[model samples]
Target: MKHALLGASKAAQWINCPPSARLQESVPEDPSEYAEEGTVAHALAEIKLRRRLTLCDSKQRKALDAEYEKIKTNPFYGPEMEQAVQEYVELVEIRVMAAKARSSDAVVLLEEHLDYSDWVEEGFGTGDVVLIADGVLEVIDLKYGKGVPVSAYNNPQPRLYGLGAWAGYNYLYSIDEVYMTIIQPRLDSVSTDIMPIADLLEWAESVVKPAAVLAFAGEGDYCAGDHCRWCKVKGNCRARADENMKALAYEFKDPALMDLEEIGSILFITEQLKVWAKDVEDYASGQAMKGNPIPQWKLVEGRSNRSISDKDAAIAALRATELGTDKFLKPEELLGIGELEKRLGKKEFAALLGTWIVKPPGKPTLAPETDTRPAMNSVENDFANTDMED
Candidate 1:
């Protein structure tokens, strides 16, 4: 799909950075397998949703089925994806039914184009699902990846989509509020946030419009933060390098021991350091590949290991050896809880072996207080452990 320079998907980035949208256009990103898998999952979810909602006529249904069959032929498509997408479809269906209850002419549109150009110049994006009723306009985005948990509260992406939805449908319905949602089936998360129409427009004018004007004209200061993770030019951006250098200066703070404030500061930029270091390495490698090597750096073969050319043939030869198959084979092991769940599915797995399943406490780790997970009580845990021992 063709994307506008100021797309809703990257609203969080450009709105925050203000200068990254045009900077990103210079360095094109290579497509990954994960993105392809997400596309397939979205297609599957859309098909199931259209069928359940009876949004398709007979001819359209047949075409949709054909497209679904074609998607099944892809290596990424599987029952696990189907189950996850089914959950998404059912969730959407529930909302659609609710919308119907309130408004007989409720609209449920999938993969619909949205125009937020009023606030952002030529800014548009595709919404995964859009629900329009008399009072509320809802925009739901499907995130197939499980790497990061996305929230709807004050999230710029869905908010922009909500703006576009409201702009396109306000005449058809008396929309008073906007409902923004994000559904990450892989993470089993459904985040919803409500904002009044007045508030939504207020944000658009005060925040989105000013930043978008700067972004579209490529005339703003370069700011670096979490949003830089999505910027294509991050590896070589001088602003990011300068920020990282400034952030790294804290390392010079007492080497012997650290105070809580110093430790917190270090922790804040730890991930940023790692991401910057890796991106610089990749950038250097790409430059070297193009015969633009660094002055003192030279490329050489990195460490590698040999592997069997044909695993099946190698295994057969190993089995014929006098050393016996024991040398090559290990004892069979049971699948992990997650793998088993995938094979049996959540419902069936729970029904058959829910009693046997147990969840152990995860190792304690440091995180920002903004994290929604409850903080671990180390003192209470130790007391409980002592009591149990006695």
Candidate 2:
């Protein structure tokens, strides 16, 4: 399926930074194996749900074999992949049962195609599963990626799905409440946000509609923030560069002269500046790999560790030389403390090893006073404590 220019997955980015929608048009999307795997996972989940609901048409049934075969071609398809899809399917089944129990007339929609073009031009998306009851509508979205823990609270993608679902089923059902659920089984996270229809529509009119208009028209400023994570133009976004540059251009002043507010603002921008710097470096490296060299920069072989050309052959040669096993092999060591903690489970590990655990004081670092972690004791305080101990 083709992705819309302003897809729901990117709603957070374009909604906040409207110009990004048009800016991304010129930059081609970077293809990733991860994305391919995610698509396969979604397809498998859709197949499972459709089979359970028996919602597929004859044409869809005919295409199922090809779709299943296509999934097999994906390197990511395996027992683990099937297990994860099964977990998501089970959750959807539970939701479906609950919704039907509330109202026998309730309907469950699988991979439902929805259009919200009335609110935003060309705005449409597919909902993984949508449940509509007498006065409630639920949109359940499965997130296959575990890099970011997605939450439904104030999440734009799921909310947009909810909006699309309500638009499609509003005439049939009196949906007073809309529920958006994100199932991220890899992270063991299931987040749901309940929104009143009145509030969602109000927000759409006030914030989303206005932004969508500007974005579609290509007439808005590019404001950079966390939302730039997946924007196609992020590699060379001038607005992002300008924002990061401003952080670097801060004038030097005496530490005593800086006010608390000024220091706090600097701290906030510094972390963003660090991330932007890394993004720039990574983008340049990727371009360099395609024979587009950055000025005064060229790739060089990175440091590598030594390894046997063929482990078995090397072992055979060592044995032929009459080398003892003890001479050729290293002694096994206990697993790392972190690995043990994970294996034993958090509570069990903590209970068993609590007495042995000692967290050394972290090195003093600068941060905004507003940071939640308590400030490290002052040098004077540390010395005072030492003196008292003496």
Candidate 3:
């Protein structure tokens, strides 16, 4: 279990690490079999959609058969491929129906690698779907994550894919506007957003360039926290050591012992530690700036509060339910000390109270014992009498 956890951590690390760093650190393992499965599912969906658009008799079964044949020999496909293929076929059918109902055109690109640059220095990605209808292009990406639906807005990967699609189709034919969509069949939802060419270029310049630089330099810092629990190098990272020490100290030590004096001392030292850590991080950043190959580190925050527009409506609806307001008793409505005594009788209530009010564990109450003065030794008097006798 430990080894598996470690392997998973390394996999996650590799994903965020820059390509150059990945090349340096042997060949980072490809994403898990599940990721491959998702790709197969996406590929099948694209193939099915393409057949439906091109063929006059585009029966669902025919499309499914073609998809199955395409994936049969692939080493990536496993036992779960059958189920994934079934889901993909159903999703494609649903999408086709929706497009037909809306009187919209749907086109799919099968294994189409859209290259933006002639030299292909950096700009290129395979687009799964490039839908052209009503004089607008919609780039749709398929995701298989069961969590929250993937959003295309502000997502670099999808945007890059969109750029590739734009370059490919525009160079071939012509396009005025482009819309990006991320469809998560597992979640049964599609998130759509739009980006202008100019905006996308700006994103590439401002975001992608910097990320690429850091990744190329292999200067990503060791960010140790809750995330370190899943980091590949957690066992060896100094930051992890510091974190573990702090955690253990907090857990075992008495809270009362962490008085103002101790807290103040820690706070003072913490500032110094922060400065030193930042200095190291800045050194790495400098190396990245110098074009030294390094892994990439992105600053990601914890989950933020979600905005709920219908909060009041939700509360009102909950109150209307049988297991809501009627089932809950107000805190103030509960019996008080005096009332309890009256109901249960003084003796019973006293006994209950004795059990209820818990006493804390006793503390050491030892006092110092002292002697007022030293006593003369009996041996000295015995020696004086013995000398007289001699």
Better model by lDDT, 1 or 2? 1
Clashes of each: 0, 0, 9
lDDT of each: 0.88, 0.85, 0.55
**Where does candidate 2 stray beyond 4 Å?**
53-74, 78-80, 251-265, 330-390
Lowest summed lDDT window (length 10), candidate 3: 1-10
Instruction: In model 3, state the lDDT of residue 60.
Output: 64
- How close is every model to the real structure, measured as TM-score? 0.90, 0.80, 0.45
Residue pairs whose backbone atoms clash in candidate 2: none
Off by over 4 Å in 1: 251-257, 321-324, 337-345, 348-355, 379-390
| lDDT string, candidate 1, 1-390, tens digits | 788999887888899888889888867766889889999999898888888886568899999899899988989887678778888888888888988998998998888899999999999999999999879899999998888788899899999999999989898888999999899987899999999999999999999999999999998988888888777787889999999999877645556778788778788788789999998888889889889988899999999999878999988888787886678987799898888877776777788899999889899998898977999888789899999999
Q: What is the Cα root-mean-square deviation between model 1 and the actual structure?
A: 2.8
Q: Is candidate 2 or candidate 3 better by lDDT?
A: 2
Model 3 score (lDDT): 0.55
Cα deviation of 341 in candidate 1 (Å)? Answer: 4.4
Q: Candidate 1 clashing pairs? A: none
**Cα lDDT tens digits for candidate 3, 21-56:** 333354334356666767666666656555555553
